[model samples]
Target: MLRSLLPIVEHAVKGPVWDCQMCGQCVLHETGMTCPMTCPKTLRNGPCGGVAVDGACEVKPEMQCVWVKANHRAENLPLLPQSWRDEIGHLRAPVNNSLAGDSSWMNLVSGADRKTPTGWKGSE
Candidate 1:
């Protein structure tokens, strides 16, 4: 219903600044709003071994690695949990287009087609 329309608005708002890939597992809350999809390697856990001298991404030398920036921000933000600083890992799996324009928040809450987090809710 109304929640379904929220994505259309969120996509319009968050897409530009965040380069939102619409991964369906939005990690913005975990990553200081730096979209993990911006990582060329899509490395969710952290920077790959090849982070450059200036902390730029190895895969995309011109750009800063999102994880490095996320770690820094995570440290300063009071509400962000300490565990998020160490909790880098793969985000579910790549989502298909069928979920392209949906509300990830609602999907996660409803447990519709979403993949549960590992070790969450007794998942293996």
Candidate 2:
């Protein structure tokens, strides 16, 4: 089924393009397809406010700031659902490593996961 094939396909396609870590809770749609793994701080929302003048990452100056690009991209798209828009910085849940490299779509289908934003925490 399509759910079973999602992991393999995403790893192949998004892995190289986005440096995806296969965290099994894809936020690409909310993030303008920008992978948070690309951020040195692993920030899921937006930039850390330390971006360089050219919109380069502060932690890795040579790289473009993903959040900046995501913000810009969001502007041109149709309005997202209020929840998605409200979750710009707060929606990221802790990655469940038990599900790493698996199908997040399947997780959603099984009610094991959701795209809804959750509170940040230091430990489970």
Candidate 3:
């Protein structure tokens, strides 16, 4: 009844959210078939303790964890080397606007450059 209709109504209201261009294959093919793009936290290394031993994502228990899927994908690709695992040790936080060369967003959002320091002097 209402429960069955809910899905139809929801789909009509929020259509196309589930559609993906499959461009994500680029991440897999280029990076040892490991997909950091689809991950919610976008972890490139491994699970963030947000998955159970059974490979269920803590954020969404009903769905397979991204890390687990990535591991499986990696296993099948013989050409894919394990070198990426070494690089993960030096993983840095994904840069946002400030570090992505879009400093204007940072300035607008954080007001970082709204005023100069009190003692600062600049040539006119």
Best by TM-score: 2
- Pairing residues by index, what is the TM-score of model 2? 0.70
Q: Estimate each model's TM-score.
A: 0.69, 0.70, 0.42
Top lDDT hit? 2
lDDT of 1 at 35: 79
Indicate whether candidate 2 or candidate 3 has the larger lDDT: 2
Whole-model lDDT per candidate = 0.69, 0.73, 0.49
lDDT of 2 by residue, 17-72 (tens): 87888877777777766777678887875789899989999988888888888776
Q: After superposition, how far is residue 19 of candidate 2 from its true place, in Å?
A: 3.5
lDDT of 1 by residue, 9-62 (tens): 778888888788776667677676577777888766667888887899887778
Better of 1 and 3 by TM-score: 1
Candidates ranked by lDDT: 2, 1, 3
Q: Give candidate 2 misplaced runs (Cα > 4 Å).
A: 1-6, 77-90, 115-124
Query: Which regions of candidate 3 fall more than 4 Å away from where they truly are?
Result: 1-31, 81-93, 96-124
Cα deviation in Å at residue 50, candidate 1? 1.4
| Stretch of 10 with least lDDT, candidate 3 | 18-27
